[model samples]
Target: MTGANKQRVDVAIVGGGMAGASLALMLAHFCPHLSVALLEQRALPDADASVRLPSFDTRATAIAAGSLQLFSELGLWNQLRDYCAPIERIQVSDRGRPCGMSMRAAQQPRASFAGMLGAVVENAALGPVLHRALAQTQTQVLAPARVNRVRMVADGAQLDWSAGAGCPDTQLQAGLLVVADGADSPLCRGLGIVTERIEYRQRALVTTLGVQRDHRGTAYERFTDAGPMALLPLPRRDGSHRMALVWTCSEEDAAILRELPEHEFIARLQKRFGWRAGRIERAGRVSDYPLSLSLAREQWRRNLVLLGNCAHFLHPVAGQGFNLTLRDCYGLARALAGADLAQNSTVGLELLEAYGRDRRLDQQLTIGFSDRIPPLFASPGLFARGLRQAGLLALALTPPLRAGFVGQAAGFGL
Candidate 1:
């Protein structure tokens, strides 16, 4: 509702969550001359010291070594270091089975190539840090703005959105449209992009827990009949070791566990996860998310590209969801940097093709691996169980195999 009803930019990003914010920042840092706009329905929360975000309230994310390097290159890692808990080692095992495999960062040939294997950061901490970094950039941010429609014009694409905070209902035109919306993306649906989906009939129970003993910078992945349970390390607070818990199980069981008493819930988790990280003394708020694989059959159009969960929703078995998206955004940034924005439509097509070609292999490898691992562990059949055990044994006995696993976990596929 203002004088300037339209805006023109070189790039327009929909959904200003972790992935969208990241792409905007990358473009700002690497391709400063390009005009970029980040459209978000939710307003960016203040990154001040006194603020606490509901999104960051009880969740934590594992950032692979490769992702950390990208943050470092953008000069934002220093802001995030204080909130990060480094993961120096990882242990994976089948519950009640003797077969298992472990990897230590120090055992790698180039131990310090990327330092620690990975790190964990609470969402409460990560969101603001990213928002602050975005604030430092020249990218125009349209928060509390809902996209009403998207039209592919002759030159590029045009977006119409209504903003809150007394802002105008504006229009945006850009050569490139980067859709980083989450899994249930309306934009993706409107664009007629189909998703190949597989419902796993499982729900992930996510919470933070206080451990009796130190986690020692180690992350644990315990596969059981219920599903895969991951205990990722978090920094100690008040001398208590904290670990992020992701336990997957049936929907009925998840509903029961979510309603159980904290002590009782921890007890059940302990019975399944064992005492690897010491006694599970207490738990924070528990939340559950349904598990499914949603992969967009087409990632790009003439002037559009999809990123993050909208592009591919993984099982989260190996904590590769966000990491893989980070790599995709990285590739897009590199591609855009070399393209000519003056020839909007032609360059947009060129960038989309080049970016898709460069990212296809990595996407296939990561998505295929994520899809396969969960089923192998979830199967209760004797042959499946035996295969799981044998695979673990092989991983333990073979150094090159172990190295490949480590590389994949660290965000570098074999």
Candidate 2:
């Protein structure tokens, strides 16, 4: 009903997932005078309930040091701190190799919170936290809304959408349009922005596992012949040590693994990951996603910008997908905060251009690292295997290089 009459805002975000919600918050904090609108397809559950968007499912994301600082700057870190589990150590190993590299929080000079490498927060907790924060802001949120059409007009972009179930169709006008609608964004396609996607021929199987021994704030990344298996630390209600598992494998192998019994699944997982974190006591629901490196050929158009997975989707190798986007959101917010919007209804081209230019290096590095590293470690070739093991050995032996790597992983490379 609210959209029945044309509503005008300075920024209209098409998807209210992490990136979109984050941008709304950033605007609310830094540019409170600017009117903002967010249109989301999924409706939030009742206040007491916690059903979350599929994008923000049960999967846990590794929050880098830089991201934590950014959240703190935005006054959001306190809200998320309770749900986070610190990643104090990371052990990277090859399945058949004799040696591996261990990155400790103490090894990096800048590591904070008693040498915390990073932190992990489950989506089930994060999504609601974000939505609640959005609710507290002045940004208008329209959920369970279906966007029927988007048109680029001379003044700005116009959205024809219907809010809620059986709601009447309404129109909205915005000076700038932000598309954070994930990788398969119809809006991006409609705008003739082609995606360059490289299929890795692998699928990521994700689940949470209860361990017999405490994880001790350590994350393990084991590179097996099948693919990479990463076990990130988590906290359980029963005071049990939980680890979030992200295992990459061939499609056929993934199919087999997904159907295996809990006991059998844990057995197989232990074989690949070893007894580093001790025996896996139990397994949770398993979910799988196809792995790919996808980038939008064009991220910006006149009065329009794309963010997050809509702009680029990276392999989950380093868990850099969300981290990179968070940085992008921060940059865009800074650009908007400093720009003079009084002269025009929409943000100026100069501001947009500068923002794009600023993000180019970070995007290229993050995307390239995610794209190249997975295959190098996952490769079955003898040369690739040797290279990976040797690289790990060198990293272990070289302190300066290791510190640099840690800094990069902390998202300080940009």
Judging by TM-score against the true structure, name the best candidate. 1
Specify the poorest-scoring 10-residue window by lDDT in model 1: 48-57
Q: Per-candidate TM vs. native?
A: 0.95, 0.94
Clashing residue pairs in candidate 2 (N, C-alpha, C atoms within 3 angstroms): none
lDDT of 2 by residue, 1-414 (tens): 453487889999999888998888888998887889999988865535654323212589998888887788777778888888888889998888888999888777574443587898988877778888888889899887888889988878999898766777799999999999898999888888899999999999998888888888898888887778899988654656688999999999999999999999988888878898998988888999999989998888778899999899988886889999998998898888898775238865677899999999888888898998877887888899888888898899999888877777787765
Candidate 1: what lDDT? 0.86
Q: What ranges in model 1 sit over 4 Å off?
A: 1-3, 48-57, 109-114, 165-168, 343-346
User: Which ranges in model 2 have alpha carbons more than 4 Å from their true place?
Assistant: 1-4, 46-57, 111-114
Q: What local lDDT score does residue 53 receive in model 1, on the 0 to 100 scale?
A: 33
- At residue 122, candidate 2 shows an lDDT of 88
Report, for every candidate in turn, its global Cα lDDT versus the true structure: 0.86, 0.85
- TM-score of predicted structure 2: 0.94
lDDT tens per residue, model 1, 1-414: 454787788889999999999999999987887888999999777756553433222788999887888899999888888888898888999988899988887886442235688899988888789888898888889888899889887777889888865655688889788899899899999989999999999999998899899898899999988789999999777667789999999999999999999999989988888889999988988999999999999999888899999999999788999989999988999887776655344345766888899998888888898898888988889999999999999999998888887777676653
